[model samples]
Target chain A: MLTKRIIPCLDIHERRVTKGVRFKNNIDLGDPVEMATRYYEEGCDELVFYDITASSERRPIDLEMVREVARAIRIPFAVGGGITSLDDMSAVLLAGAEKVSINTPAVLNPELIEEGARRFGAQCIVLGMDPVRSDNPACPSGYEITIRGFREYTGIDALEWARRAESMGAGEIVVNSVDADGTRAGFELNITRLIAENTGIPVVASGGAGNPRHLAEVFIKAGADAAIVAGMIHTGEYSIAQIKNELHQAGIPVRRHW
Target chain B: MTAIIDYGAGNLTSVKLALQTLGVDALITSDPDRIMAAERIIFPGVGAAGAAMESLRKLGLQEILHTVTSRGTPFLGICLGTQIIFQHSAEDGGVDCLGLLQGQVIRFAPADRRDKVPQMGWNAVSFVREHPVLKGIADGTEFYFVHSYYPVPDDDAAIIGQTGYAGVDFAAVTGRENIAATQFHPEKSGRAGLQLLENFLRWKP
Candidate 1:
């Protein structure tokens, strides 16, 4: 069976795994490479490294740091933040990331999705979307897309944007709810089910996973292929093994080697 | 020397790094000479199967790979590299492939898409029979995979392992004589991935 993925996302800020509530109030955890290695040892299914401040800082992703993390761990890893072009995507892949996640640039220039998939293959291109509720019912999803680190709303309907991304060849979509991000309340399931049910591509529900129960709910009820758990893992509230164990008992299939 | 064939695909560097993690050095090459000269060969591919086959032909590697494997030189293919060893693939709409192995690659049907087409994630595999690659790896050990299409080998003799996805079982690993290939990306499968690669280093098939 295709097991549900328990990915520990490392929000990188200047080479450190930084934490913030709802994408603010930055707090440094430690060296990213070291943290990533620890998570890999804990048996996390995958790792996601987001250069949280890259777009606002106006710089490229830290390739040297990416190389260090890639070398330290052996699992498939995805890198996002400040990935604006094909050159950037290729560089990250060469540095050893299995996939590259694009949020800001993908929305601003949707061609990046098509071009990245064309050059690297669809499986290597991941579309990262930040969605928040919008007023317009005609918006299809009733949620507008946000970019530039969730500071700017693109006014693009989240559901339509996801379908467009898949058409343009995004292999996976990470539907991150800006409203639920860092809130620890639970995932925005309505939107999650809305997007996952709508797109043929696998959907990864991001944000608002405070515990194992939330993870189970997302996988079993929300129809998410994977759930990105950040704050809880970083805060040492639950190890990857513990989370997977809880899920396994809950009848959610997860990889168990350790 | 072990040769890691790079045919304009994705992340060949990471495969080299995985070998390094196993304390094994591999020569990353697109050069047909290096590949032919190596004692062992590892062909890693990611992307469209048609394009992968095209790159192998362009680099003059298709013939060399077939020749080497037939001569009993230990060879391993990963992901798309594994699929290209088959007769045909439905990926780019029934593209003809290297035909080095007796198999046809086909897409998981729309009914199977309930789990998503690519079926990307970690799933356990039970080996059909023990081989050198299964040395330290236990049955049901998890391996990472990312693919839309999977190969269906004509002969059951080539089948070495199987994995079930969305109520459908597929050949996860296939091997015969000197050649072994996996539908999953063992290079990125963490410890189990590296262990399989390490076993490949000492495999004398």
Candidate 2:
């Protein structure tokens, strides 16, 4: 059976895990490697590490932090943010990341997605879509996709962009909701479902996970292959073990810990 | 020493780092001499079939890899590296491959009931046959995967492990003689993934 994934995301800046409300008011969490290893032990299916400061600083991925996390954990890790070129993707993959997540670079140069996918294989390439709902009545249900941590709007429809990404060879799409982020209300299931339904690639729903039931609802209702929980896990509100147990009881097939 | 073949494709760092974590001395190089001289070779790749094959030809590594594997030297192909072992790829409008294995790589059919391409994330696998590559690996172990195309072995007996996606059972791990390849990234698969790598290291054949 193809099981649903329960992923824990770590937003890293200067090698430390951090999170905030709406991508602002950043708060330091703890060492990324420690948190990653803990998540792995607690039965998280996989981990996503976004070098949130890399793109803003106009630099390469933090290989040091990547190496530390890779060395400590045994789970698959996806590294994102500031991955602009094939060289950047190669550097991070060599540094211990299983997959490279590209956002602004991929959109800026659509060929980069094709080239990267061709060079490394689509499976190694992941496209990150940070979407914010638009107020314009014409595009009510549609949202504006943001890049570089919500600094710039691509004016591209989220669902449309996700389909384009799949056509361009993105193996997976990380549908992150800017509106529901940090609110802990729940995941933006409508947005996630829209993307998942429109494409064939696995969809990982990010942002607004308040509890285990929230994760379950996202998988069961929205039909996401995985639900990414950051704030809830980082704040120690819910442990991954408990969440997996609850999800299992709720009929979601998650990887069980030995 | 283990030499990881680098053809300017995807990252070889994580594979190298994983080898280092296991206290194994490894090197990432495109040099044919070094690659051929290494005790074992890891054909690690993460890119498209056409470009990867092109880079291999550009670096003159195709023959070297053939020589090493032909001599019965241990060879492990990861992801695209595993796919290129076939005769050709349908990606990029058909590309010639190393022809190490007989078959053609094709894109996965979209979900019958409207599923997505590029099946990503952690998925489970069932071992097909007993082999050193999967030694100590139990059934129902979930390994991470990210790809749209999968290998169809010319010799069905070569397949050592299998995983299903969208109702299709694809080859997860295929072993023949000294050549062993995995569509999944064992380095990124966590504990079970690491254990699989360890088994590869200890494989005597």
Interface RMSD to the true structure, each candidate:
1.1, 2.5
Candidate 2, residues A1-258, lDDT tens digits: the string is 567888899998888888988779999999988888888888888899998888989988889888888788776789999989989988887677778999888888888888887777777788998999886444445787888778887777787788889998888889889989888999999999888777877889998999999989889888898889998888888998889889889988787633
How large a fraction of the reference contact set does each model reproduce? Answer: 0.80, 0.65
Model 1 DockQ (Cα-based):
0.80
How would you encode candidate 1's per-residue C-alpha lDDT over B39-94 as one tens digit per residue?
Answer: 99998888888788888788898789888888889999899999989999998777
Q: Label model 2 with its docking quality class.
A: acceptable
Q: How accurate locally is residue A227 in candidate 2, as Cα lDDT from 0 to 100? A: 86
Q: Model 1 clash pairs?
A: none
- Those runs of model 1 whose alpha carbons end farther than 4 Å from true positions after fitting are none
Best model number under DockQ? 1
Count of backbone clashes, every candidate in sequence: 0, 17
